[model samples]
Target chain A: MAATNLSERRLARFWSKYGFVLAVLVPILLWFSIFSFGPILYALYASLTNTHSLDPSRARFVGLDNYISLLDDRRFLASMSNVFRFVLVKGILNIVLSLGLALLLERLRRGRNFYLFFIFMPVVISQVAVAMLFLWLYDPRLGLINYLLSLVEIPPQSFIRSTAQAIYSVAIADVWKTYGYAAVIFLAGLLDIPQDYYEAAKVDGATRLQTLWRVTLPLLKNPLVLVMVLIVIDGVQHFTMVQVMTGGGPADSTLMPSILVYNYGLGANNYRMGYACAISFIMFVVIMAITVFQLRLFRSLYD
Target chain B: MTDISLDRRAGGSLPSGGAGADARIRLREQVIALVTHLLLVIFAFIAFGAMMWMVLASFKSASEIIAKPPTFLPEAPTLESYALILREQAFGRFFLNSIFVALPSVLLILFSSSIAGFVFAKFDFPAKEVIFTIILSTLMVPPAVTLLPLFRLVSRLGWADTYQALIIPVCVSAFGIFLLRQFMEGLPSELLDAGRIDGASNWWIYRHIVLPLSVSALSALAIFSFLANWDSYLWPLVIIYEEKMRTLPLGLAYLLGWSSRPRYDLFLTGAVITVVPVVVFYSFFQSRFVRGVTLTGLKY
Candidate 1:
C-alpha cells in the first residue's frame, strides 16, 4: 500500500510539471496537423491518383500519369512562360522604382514620413479593389490611359483585351500596387546603414555614382534579396487580381498556374483534381528551387 | 535651401578661394535636393492620385463615369452609386460579413499565437526545435499546394457555406506563432519565476504578466491578420456559395460579372467602401503597420 502511494505521487508530480506545456502544445500541434500539414500530405497523395474533386472515393492510382501528361500540356507550358515574364517585369520595375524611391527618401531631412504615408497607402488596400481600379484605368475606349494617349494622337490600345499587351499590362498593375512595400523594406535597410560609410566614401574621393555602386548597393543586399524573393513568390502564386482582371483570357495569354489549378479542379466539366494537384505541386517545386537558388546566389555574392 | 544660406555665411568667413568652391558645391547640392523633392512629389502624387481619383469617381453618376476624357472631379457628385450598391448588391451584408469573419479570426489568432508563443518562449520540452522547425517550414509551402486538398476537406466536412469554413482554416497563423515567439523570448523570465514562486499557475502568469507585456506584438499581429482576412479572396470564391456569406473582396469581384457590361460607377463605389475602412485603420496605426512589415518581412 505504501509503495502504491509513492508511485501515484510520482505520477502526479510528472503531470504537474508537464501538464501546461502539453495543454497548449497538443491543441496547436493538432491544429497544424489538421489545417496546415494534413492538406499538404493529402495533396501529395492525390497528385499520384486520378481523383475527382467532387467524388474522391472513385480515385484510382495513376502513378505519375498527371506529372507526365503536364510535360506536353499546351496550357501548362503557356502558364510557365507567362509567369516567367510576369516575374521578370515585376522584379525589374519593382526593384528600380523602390530602390530609387528609397534613395530619394533617405536624402530628405523633412517630409519623409509625409511622402512615405501616401506612397505606402496602396500596399494596405484590397487586391480586388486595386484590380477594379486598374480595370477601369486599362479600359480600351473610355479609360483614363487611352484618353491620355489620344492627346498625343496615339490610337487607343486594348490593354487587357489584346493578347500581346495583356500580361505586361497586368504585371504593371501588380507592380504599381506592390512596389511601395519593397520601398518600405529598402528604406528600413537604408536607415540601418551607418552614415559613416557614406562619409568614408566621400573622404576617399568617390563620386555619387561610385558611392551608389560600390557602397550603397553592396550594403543593401539583404533587403534586395528579401524583396526579390517576395516578388517571385508573389508573382508565381498571383491569382486574385489577374483572375479578376482577365480570367486568363485573350487566348490564355495571361494564364497562371494557380488559375489552372482552380479551373481544372472546379470549373465546369473539369473536375480533374489529380491534374490540378500536380500543377500545384510543380508550382511548389519551382518556387522552392528558385528561392533556394536566390539564397545561394546572394550568399555567394556577399559572403 | 536654408542649409545653403547657412553654409554661405560660414563660407563668407572662410578664405576667398575656398568660398568659391564651397558656394559652387552648395549650389550643386541645392539643385540635387530640388530635383529629388520634385521626383518624390511625382511619386507620391501617382501613388495617392489613383486612389483619390477612384474616390471621386465613386461619387459620379453612371453616365458621367463613362464620359470621354474623364472629369477630374464629379460634375454632380451624387450619392446614387453608393446607394445602389448598398441597397441592390447587398454590399452592406458583405461589409458585415467581412467584419464578423475578420474580428473572430484575428482575435483567435492573437490568442492562439500568444499562448503558443508563450509556451515556446517560457517552457522547456522535448522535440521543441523539431516542432518549431516544422511549423516554420509551413511558411515556405505555397498556398496553391494546399488549395485543392483544403477545399476537399472543408467540403467534406459540409462547411462549404459557413463562417466557420473561412474562420477555422486560418485561425492559427504559423507566421503569427513565429512572430510572437520571437517577441516573447525577449520578455524577462524573472517575472514569471517570481509568479511561480508565489504559487501561481502557468495560465495565471500568462494572463497577468505575459499578456500585458505582449500587447505591442499582439497589436502588430492583429492588424496584419485582420487586413489579410479582410482581403482574402480565393478561398472564399472556392467555398462560399451563398450571397449572404460573401466577404467584401469576393463581393466586389462579383461586381465585374454582375451585369453584361462593366459598371464603373458601382465597381468604384464598392471598391471605395471596401478600401476606406482599412485605409482609415492603417492611417491611425501607420508606424505599427510599418514596424510589422520590418519585424515579419511580410505585407498582407
Candidate 2:
C-alpha cells in the first residue's frame, strides 16, 4: 500500500511539472496543423483541381494537369531561364565582389568602421526603396550611370528597356543591394583566422599572395558555405525587386518563378490558383533539396 | 585591438624597420593599404552618392531632373513634390497603414516568441530535442513555398486587406523563437531555481527572472522584426487592393500610377520618405544589428 501511494505521488509530480509544457505544445501543434501543414495540404488539393479564383464554385478535380501544362508554358520556361541567368551571373559576381571587399576591408588601417557602415547602408534599406533607387539609377537620359558613360565616350544605352538587358540590369541592382551583406559575413570569417597560420607561412618565405591562398581561403570554409547557402536561398526567392522595377516586362524576360506564381494567382485575368499551387510546390521541393544538399556539404566540409 | 597590433609587430615589421631596404618595403605596404582605403572610400562614396542624389532629385523640378547634365544638386530646391505626394496621393494614409501593420506584428512576434522561447529554454520535456530540431529545419524552407496556400487560407478566412491577414500569419516566427531560445539557454539556472523556491510559478519566473535577463536578445529581435515587417511589400501587395490600405512601398509604386509619364520627383520623394524612418531606426540600433548578426553566426 505504501509503495502504491509513492507511485501515485510521483505520477502527480510528473503531471504538475509537464502540464504547462503540454499547454505550450498545443499552440505549436495547432500552428503546424493550420498554417504549415494546412497550406501544403490545401495546395496539394488545389494542384489536383481546375480551380479559378474568379469562379471557385465551378472547381473540378484534375490530376497533374496543371503541372503538365506548366511544362509547355513558354512564360514558365522563360522564368526558369531567367532564374538560371540570375543565379549564375548575379550569384558569382556578388560572391567575388563581396569576397574582395571583405579582404580589402580586413587590410584597412583606419576608418574601417565608417567604411563598413557605409557599405552596409544599402542592405538596411527596404528592398522596395532599393528598387526605386535603382529605377532612378537606371534612367536612360538623366541617370548618373549614363552621364558617366557619356564622359567616357560611350553612348547611353537604355537599361531595363531592352528584353535582353532587363533581367541583367535587375540582377545588377540586386547584386549592388546584397553584396555588402556577403562582404560583412566574409569579414567576420576573416577575423576568426589565427595570426599564427599567416606567421608560419611568412616564416617559410611565402609571398603575401601565397600566404593568403594557403592560409586564408581554406580556413574560411564554414562562413563561405554559410554565405553561399544564404545567397542561394535568397536568390531563389527573388520577387519584390522584379515585381516593382520591371513588372516582368519587355515580353516577360525578367519574370522569376515567384513573380510568375503571384501573377497566376492574382495579377492575371484568369487567376489559375491550381497552376500557381503547383509552381509553389515545385519551388518548395527545389529549395528543400538545395538546402539538404548544402547542409550535407557543410557537414562534410567541416568534418 | 591589442592583439592585432602585437601580431603586426611580430610578423617581421620590427626587423624591417632596422634597414633601408625595409623602409622601401614598408612604404610599398603603406601605398597598397592606401590604395585599398581609396577603393573602399570610392565604394562608400557611390552608396552615399546614390542616396544623396535621390534626396536632391526629390526636391528638384521634373524638367531639371530630366534636363541635360542632370542637376547634381537641385538648382532651386522646392517642396512641390512633397506637397504633391501629401495632397494628391494617399502617402499619409500609406504611412499610417504600414505602421499599423508593422507595429502590431512586431509586438505579437516578440510576445509570442519570448513566451515560447522561455519554455523551450528552461523546461525539460519529452521529445524536446526533436521538437527543436523540427523548428530549426523549417528555417531551410523558403517563404515562397507558402505564399499561394497562405493566400488561399487568408482568403478563406475573409482576412484580405485587414491587419489580421498580415499580423496573424507572421506572428509565430520560428527564427525569433530559435534566437531567443539560444540566448535563454545561456542564462544561469540558479536564478530560476531561486524563483521557484520562493513559490513563483513558471509564468512569474519568466516575468521576473527570464525577461529581464534576456533584454538584449529581445531588443535585437525586435529591431529585426520591425525592419522585416516595415519592408514587407509582396505579401501586402497581394492582399491589399485599395490604395488607402497600401503600405509605403506599394503606395510609392502606385504613386507613379501605371502612367507613361512617370513623375520622377514625387517618386523620389516617396522613396526617400519610405527609406528615412528605417535608416534612422537602424542607426539608433546599429550596434545591436552587428551583435545580432554576429551572434547568429556563432550560434550556427
Best prediction by DockQ: 2
In the range B1-300, model 2's lDDT, one tens digit per residue, is 101210122332223334556677788877987899889989888777788888888888778877888778789888888888899887888899889989998998888788888889999988988988877766665566677778777888898888888888888788888888888988999999999889988888888889999888888778778877888888888777777788998888776564587667777889999988988877776666655555554221
Show model 1 residue runs off by greater than 4 Å.
B1-21
How does candidate 2 score on lDDT?
0.80
Clash pairs of candidate 2?
none
Q: Which stretches of candidate 2 lie over 4 Å from their true place?
A: A1-15, A295-303, B1-21, B297-300
RMSD of each: 4.6, 3.5
Please give, for residues A1-303, the per-residue lDDT of candidate 1 as tens digits: 999899999989988988998999999999999999999999999999999999988999999999999999999999999999999999999999999998999888678778888999998999999999999999998899999999999999999999999999999999999998898788878776777777788789999899999999999998899999999889999999999999998899999999999999999899999999999999999999999999999999988
Candidate 1 TM-score versus the reference: 0.96
The CA lDDT at A205 in model 1 is 95
DockQ of 1: 0.47
Across A171-216, the per-residue lDDT of candidate 2 in tens digits comes to 9999888888777777877776767777788789999788777788
TM-scores of all candidate predictions against the true structure: 0.96, 0.92
Model 1, B126-226: lDDT tens digits are 89999999998998888888998999999999999999999999999998988889888989999999999999999999999999999888887898898
What are the candidates' individual DockQ scores? Answer: 0.47, 0.48
TM-score, candidate 2, is 0.92
- Give the distance in Å from residue A60's predicted Cα in candidate 1 to where it truly belongs: 0.3
